[model samples]
Target: MTFSKDEQPKNIPESNTTDNVAVPKNFLIPFLLLSLKQWNMHGYKLMQVLLDLGFTTIDSSNVYRTLRQLEKDHYIKSNWEQGEEGPAKRIYSITEEGEAFLKTCHSSFLQYQQMLQTFFSIYTNSLFPISNFTDKND
Candidate 1:
């Protein structure tokens, strides 16, 4: 059966829920704020960074929505700059509050990493039992 580019399989079911299925903005917001803390960037640049970080399925709308929410929360501030080729772009920068929040995020990330490492260590040890045999002469 030939299907057009926009067509989906017949067996697939569609949902009527209005809930957003995209990745939670909370996850990306901290990273966005952290990135902006390093340097100011517009939406496109932010999108590129997110893509480079392996977030290929992120929607542009979600990115903009997160940016707006961050701005509303006072975590980020934006300014408009006229570009030579196109319309003005809104550049975002992290605020002092954002920096503090990023610090907390960093700590949480480190703790998460440690927990994952511990889990892997236990799993590997259980999966492969290593034995150390002593010589009878010794």
Candidate 2:
């Protein structure tokens, strides 16, 4: 079947619902640092918390890499804790600077949400105008 570049094959779905959409891994940095602010945890435990919080596709290496970058950037601090039966674990906690950074991130997130809301409103309204969705009784 020949199809133009702008067209999709008949069998393909046009849009994806929120439940099936995967959030990009880069979006988790703020969440990770916020969790650390609540309590210090090693990288593995942080990964587990992320998975529990619905970031199902997160990679351990990426988590560790982000943690390292956060530490290097002075947003977080870590210390080695002795383990009874294994190597010492590095536990991370949010620094004072991290708290300030988080506040900035929170503001950005709010603005981003508003931008998305505006975009979606225009997109859906364009695709399915209000008149088409109105109730017959009204």
Candidate 3:
């Protein structure tokens, strides 16, 4: 299933936030799927959860698009439910494949965290080179 250009969400917020780190696009699907594992929700609710989790600038369109993609990729599944007070809602749930994918994403995220830690260490040491810690023993 291909999402046409017009189908994509428009006018994404320019700034996510000045405080919290913005969620990377690659991590979006994993995050959404993980949340679905916790509880099934419709697109709007999913976007709300993401926004509440420090992603203040997330676009609903992007969230919906990601959901569609996840469904196409077999990482997630959805069912429409008729609402008592409003239109039907499409509820999303994580599939077994999604669970496996979430595990992979978690593993990769951990590795990425370790790499960032290593980089920070190198940066910190570079800024303040302790004489005793240098390769050349004085």
Candidate 4:
């Protein structure tokens, strides 16, 4: 089935790549911290939990780097634990500071969520005609 441009619905937002939908930026922090808040885990387990949490385009290097930064900032703490069959693995857990930071993140993200909802509502609830678009010549 083909959709005609002229037949487009008024309330539908203009088409754009799905990539622009929700690009997670600075979200890796809360995700990692939040997980650690629940339980301690090794880097491997943390990475898997991030994948399970819907971070599809994440880089392993980036995750490790971020973890290092968080550790340096004293937001999180880590220690080595001997794995059953392999070498010791570094297990990470949220520090008191990390939990405090996570709470702040929750407040900030809640505001952002409201802003995003208001933004989408404009596209989904009302008609904004193409004719209203201002020309550069104006």
Highest-lDDT candidate: 4
1-138 in candidate 3: lDDT tens per residue? 234566755544334455645677786787798899999999888888878666747877888888998999999999999989989999999999999999999999999999999999988888787864778654
Against the reference, the lDDT scores of all candidates come to 0.81, 0.85, 0.84, 0.86
Q: Give the better candidate number (1 or 3) by TM-score.
A: 3
Candidate 4 regions off by >4 Å? Answer: 1-22, 127-138
Model 3 segments beyond 4 Å from truth? Answer: 1-21, 128-138
Candidate order by decreasing TM-score: 2, 4, 3, 1
- lDDT at position 44, candidate 2: 90
Task: Write the residue-wise lDDT of candidate 1 on 1-138 in tens digits.
Answer: 355546856553345454534444467977788789888999999988877765646778988998998899999999999989989999999999889889999999899899999999988877774543455576
Tens digits of per-residue lDDT, candidate 4, 21-129, equal 4336689999999999999998878989888888766678988999999999999999999978989999999999999999999999999999999988887555675
**RMSD (CA, Å), each prediction:** 9.6, 4.6, 9.6, 9.9
* Better candidate by TM-score, 1 or 4: 4
For TM-score, candidate 1 versus 2, the one ahead is 2
Per-candidate TM equals: 0.73, 0.76, 0.74, 0.76
Residue-level lDDT for 48 in candidate 3 = 83
Clashing pairs in 4: none
Point out the higher-scoring one by TM-score: 2 or 3. 2
What is the Cα-based TM-score of model 2?
A: 0.76
Q: Considering lDDT, which of the candidate structures 2 and 3 is the better prediction for this target?
A: 2
Model 1 lDDT at residue 71: 92
